[model samples]
Target: MSEVLEGVEKAEAEAVQIREKAQSQVEEIQRDAERKARGIEQIVRTQLTKEIEALQKSVESKAKNKSQRILLKADEEAVSLEEQGTKNIKKTVDIIIKGVYAFGGGGK
Candidate 1:
């Protein structure tokens, strides 16, 4: 009877030890998972920041290039208008001179 009691006690002790070991393993796994999650969060944040910065730079570059093109086009249009004005003025002066010569008396 005493031997049977001793076997029961030993079995109970082993069960308690197994429960404690399982609990410790569970805690360790939880801690490891938390650490990994933090690492992944940081990596994602860094990548997002980089992507945003790159996009901002690209937009700025495009805006600058567009502005430059607009300025150049405006300059070209102004020059074309100036040349056209000069040509019109010259034509007006030539017509006036010929009319005055005709009025001053007929040329032989």
Candidate 2:
């Protein structure tokens, strides 16, 4: 009966040690998972920031290009109008000269 009691006590002590070790492992695993989750979140945030910046740059470049094209077209139209005005002025001068010389029966 004394031997039986010693065997039961030893088994209970071994069970207690096993339970403590398992608890420690569980805590370590939980801490590691939390750390990995934080690292992934940071990486995602950084990547998203870069992508957003790139998109903004792309949009700005397109807008600038469109503005330049509009300005160039306006300049071309101004030049065309100036050329037409110059031609009209020459025609008017010729008409005035003919009118001034009409008394002498001279015309161009």
Candidate topping lDDT: 2
Residue-by-residue lDDT tens digits, candidate 2, 3-103: 99999999999999999999999999999999999899899999999999999999999999999999999999999999988979988898999899997
Model 2: how far residue 64 lies from native, Å: 2.7
Residue-level lDDT of model 1, residues 13-90, one tens digit each, is: 999999999999999999999999989988999999999999999999999999999999999999999999897988
Local accuracy by lDDT, each model: 0.93, 0.95
Say which candidate scores most in TM-score. 2
**Where is model 1 more than 4 Å wrong at Cα?**
74-108
**Which ten-residue region of model 1 has the weakest summed lDDT?**
99-108
Candidate 2: worst-modelled 10 consecutive residues by lDDT: 99-108
Candidate 2, TM-score vs. the true structure? 0.60
TM-score (all chains, Cα) for each model: 0.59, 0.60
